[model samples]
Target chain A: MAEPNRSKDRLALSALGLFAERGFVGTSIRDIAKATGLSISNIYHHFGNKEGLLLAILKTASERLLHELQEASNQPGTPIERFKRLVQTHLQLSRGLRKEAKIFFLDEEHLSPEGYRANLKYQREILDLYREHLLALQEAGEVNFKSPTIAAFNILGVVNWHLRWYRPEGQMSFEETSREVTEFILHGISRVREP
Target chain B: MAEPNRSKDRLALSALGLFAERGFVGTSIRDIAKATGLSISNIYHHFGNKEGLLLAILKTASERLLHELQEASNQPGTPIERFKRLVQTHLQLSRGLRKEAKIFFLDEEHLSPEGYRANLKYQREILDLYREHLLALQEAGEVNFKSPTIAAFNILGVVNWHLRWYRPEGQMSFEETSREVTEFILHGISRVREP
Candidate 1:
């Protein structure tokens, strides 16, 4: 990356780190500067203020997360397969972008009014993607649900909460967690006995 | 209730609201006092400081949630009935004590180290209650799982995240949302024929 790009990346990454550790209101410009090894004034060269840094980080992560989802959905597969792909991609992203993902979940609310609205617009669109896929699966008789909104929330809540307790070196790898959680969310723990 | 009891209830409720909106670091003694129409000195008479107020809320809410769970679990009936009672009671408590619950969920880290550990002790007790119940269901062959944690996560996450989007007056009452979410979680959307 070029000089400005490198600085922005540093700012975004540092912002992510600090924001994740100590929420948005808790993080200071000095803290971000210290994390990035830049002078506070120099930090301003890349992002205007604390809120500016937050907006940049959220915009970058939001776009990246959406891109990952789009790529997964475009792959050839069964509806179930596509759903699995979505869960796997999300789990992988959550691991790779641990700090950024944490900040995204925790601090996006700190954005200025306009930025907050835009960020939520993107968030709702991503949620809508899940809703659409779920509705399709329901109509195909793959699942039983009357409300896509409830379905989407059920799926997202189960998958996204992995950030809180999912450990990379724990007994289960991220992939295993993804597979098991995905199946659990899509299919319950019960099985019918063979006649 | 006596005046003193009502006064304490108002104090705890006000503490929860400030803690939720401003967070632990952002809130001040004066802020809590202002919210409750008392001087900071008067507030101090009840609890030593912000930490005391927070500690009281956490202790009180934890006891409230588990007590409700115990009541539900003891209600007259079978395993399914017991589970439904647990779900309904949990959902009701989650709605009524949302601010305190959110503090437990998102703001526990802000507590003093001792407070944090103490809070965890209570939380672990409640989580164990849910897990042990699930274990009983599984041992009876009522539940089957490749990963028990995932199943538990789905059940709790669906209920926990209810605060995020559940409206006071939607097409579904809190009771209906509770029943609907629990039913979907317990059985999932997958049909037996499809499986």
Candidate 2:
């Protein structure tokens, strides 16, 4: 049982790397087998097919994100603080799961019909978690945004776009980058004075 | 001249639609020819190859965006207002050129080595424009953000992410949506009291 599970993990990790580099459509099952030193039959036995591997990677990615978000939401804080925490949490996860996050954004459309629907369900849940925090902030008279839905997306856009530019080995550390993002989302670029 | 230009336009438009739908790698010259009612040889005559078609589409998209952004930056306004105009202009263009924007984000990697560098140069110019406005605002003491580079990217992320969700027949009009986005970037979700 342990040996088979190890093979499955190897296939998933190899597939994730390939999918990130070559994209899902461009990466073939044989490529995954080659990367993992596993036979084609073994890959099939583990993942059923390439689409199955994609779904598994996506499911793992979404589940991890959802878990982190849920924990953030449950943290004790004011609505605004909690919202900031949620944004920070998202940034941290994106940085850590950079490959998975890239696949989430780029290759989601390649999922089979049923897999696409399942993935959408996970995505909507993530969005709703953000929306819920914004709704709470609005109720507390802390935020003045027009639509919670739009506001949620705007915040997500700011965080998710970091994937394109943020480099760990680059000048700015993740700490600095995430802080700047959180502050920008909360107060924007305009100078605000405390009452 | 007229006949040749029309053929080029038709080929470009058809290629844009196909690339957006099937992706750059998934799309072939035969597909473009079929969509435009032109032979494969005709496509080759106009584009030289599929990569050439992609480069043309990207060039047109980037040029139009730069033109609008340039106009916005030169407009008579305070730095903040000009920045808002830039954001609004970006939103409008993204909405108008939805397919092109999709291709820009998803298919850019498929460009040839030279073409990739050219596209990157265009992208950098656009980013620099945003940074310039933010620098002006920062110098004027109208805003206080850590890094103009990160802030510029944040603003772009908010605008570009809209392409993923914004719909014409949806509840929010482009005007309302763009306005909300601009306001969000300028002031964020926090309630700001007038000084």
Candidate 3:
């Protein structure tokens, strides 16, 4: 027999793929059930509702990211090293979780307010941790920017836009893109005054 | 009475605002007529059909963007200066034609294939312009990236996503965000290699 949890995992993954393409309002439990070859009853057994399933997916990814961040923050050589590791880990995690990221971005708004707020709390915590790291780098004279918040948004916009259009089949490996971004960011913010 | 053509222009602008928020499918000719106080017949006379009005809006914005790009490119300056000018012009243009930009980003697929192709052709031309500009900058040592295609997308993503979340009423002006982005892009690519 198929592993009991394996069927549920496959069902959840299929649901995520549909959610990414059709959007939350445009999808239904019947759609998920049809895609996964499971009865609607089985889908309901796995998830209380579409909202509960979306909540489960989002919370799972958030925990993965948060655990990675907490680990990276604890084990690091330098501020720059830590920042670069954060970028690297983020890129790899994003690549592996590309489908989930799409749903996380476009469908999170569909979650009920209480569920939405709960997910956002974890997301904001992630941003805050990165902001603190960048602040430390700024304090150390390693980088320069006028406003850390705007700068943080710029950094994130540059990185996170990858989810919208990045293709794994592209000419470069995920490593190359990560390296390029980190190099550009570190070099871009180098603190030397004009000669 | 206001000049009838002046009224026609106002009618088109109001249609753009409603379409941006409600999406093309969610909006209807009746809604546009109600919003503009023009009978559906009057709007039909001016724009031919609901789809016709959408295309007219698309054409107006695309032509304006193309004209601005040509003007920016014609400016006599270094490639970097030309690029910086392009960024400024684009920011200004997006701010002025925000509703149109929103429609293009959010619902271009709703346009007829012929209309969508027309819209995309202009977009491709503008994207190629940016690609060419960056290639020339790489040659001139003003900018360098491992992947110019990805870098261009990253830069444009930062600029365009502003429409979704930027506060026109906030402390930052359109020009200020434009300048900040220009600085960020240049600095993100500064030539000095510092670890």
Candidate 4:
């Protein structure tokens, strides 16, 4: 059972790397097999097809992300504290699961109808998680925003777009960059107001 | 000359629509030819091949976007006012060029090396333009942020991600949504501090 689970995990990671590099449309089962050194039949036995492999990868990634988010949500703090933890967790997870996150965006259009629905459901839950925290902050008078939905979208956008331009080897370490992002998201570019 | 230019513009628009729908990899020159009702050679006459057509479309779109940004940058206003105009300009232009914007993000990886470099240069300039405004605001003591570069990325992320979820037929009109985003970027989720 352990051997089987390890092989499946390896296959999923290998597929994710290929999908990220070549895209779902550009990657083929043969390519995945070549990358993993697994027989074509063995790959099929595991995932059924390319779409199956993608669906597995996406499902796993979403579940893991949601689990981390749940942990962040349960942390004891003010809304700002929880929000800070959420932002840090989100960025850290995103950096850690860089390839999986890339697949969630890039090859999303290729998901089968069933896969699409499942993926969208997870995505909505994630968005709703953000909105819940935001609404709590609003109620506590710690934050004011017009629409929780749109505000949530903006927050998610700030973090998600990191996958596009962030370079860990650049000027700032990921820790420093994540801290700056958390500050920007919390306070924005406006001058500090007198307390 | 007008007739040729019109034909070329029509071809680019057609290609953009197809690319957005089918993606650059899934889309074929034959599909483009069929969609545009042009023979293969005629399509070739306009753009050497599918890659050339995509390159042409991307180049034209970037140039037009930069031109609009330049106009917004030239507007008379304080940095915040100008930033508002820039945000409005970006959202409006993004709405107007929805297909182009979609193509810019979706099919960008397929660009040839030369095309990739050129596209990246234009994108960098756009980011740099945002940073300049942000830096000015920082200098004037209007805004307090650690890194102008990261702040600019956050601003752009908020708007660009609009292309993913923004719907013209949704609850808020483009004007209203753009206003909300501008406000969010200017100030963030924090409550207004008392002077």
- On DockQ, who's better, 2 or 3? 2
TM-score of 4: 0.93
Interface RMSD for all numbered candidates: 4.2, 4.1, 3.1, 3.8
**In model 1, what lDDT does residue B28 have?**
79
Per-residue CA lDDT of model 1 for A33-93, tens digit only, reads 8888878886677777777788877778788888989898869888777877877787777
Interface RMSD against the true structure, candidate 4: 3.8
Could you list the CA RMSD of all candidates, in the order they appear?
Answer: 3.0, 2.4, 4.0, 2.4
lDDT of 4 by residue, A7-103 (tens): 7778888889998888889888888888878777767788888799999898888999999988977799878788778888899899988988888
Model 1's DockQ? 0.43
lDDT of 3 by residue, A1-195 (tens): 658687678878888888766666567788988998888886678777778888887788888887987787757588878877776777677777777776765555456789879877866777777787778788877576665655666666666776665666877766677777766666545553554
**Of the pair 1 and 2, which is ahead by TM-score?**
2
For model 1, residues B1-195, the per-residue Cα lDDT tens digits are: 347656666777887898887676677787877888877775577777778888999898899889879877877786656766776778788888888877787666667789989898987777677776666666656454556665666667777777766888677677666666776666742234432
CA lDDT of every candidate: 0.73, 0.83, 0.73, 0.80
Clashing residue pairs for model 3: none
> Model 2 over residues A35-79: C-alpha lDDT tens digits?
989888887787787788899999998998899889977899877
Rank by TM-score, descending? 2, 4, 1, 3
User: Which parts of model 3 have CA positions greater than 4 angstroms off?
Assistant: A1-11, A39-49, A108-123, A192-195, B1-15, B22-59, B107-123, B171-175, B193-195
lDDT of 2 by residue, B40-63 (tens): 887788778878889999899899
Error of 1 at A23 (Å): 1.2
TM-score of A-chain in each prediction? 0.87, 0.93, 0.87, 0.92
| Better model by lDDT: candidate 1 vs candidate 2 | 2
Clashing pairs in 4: none
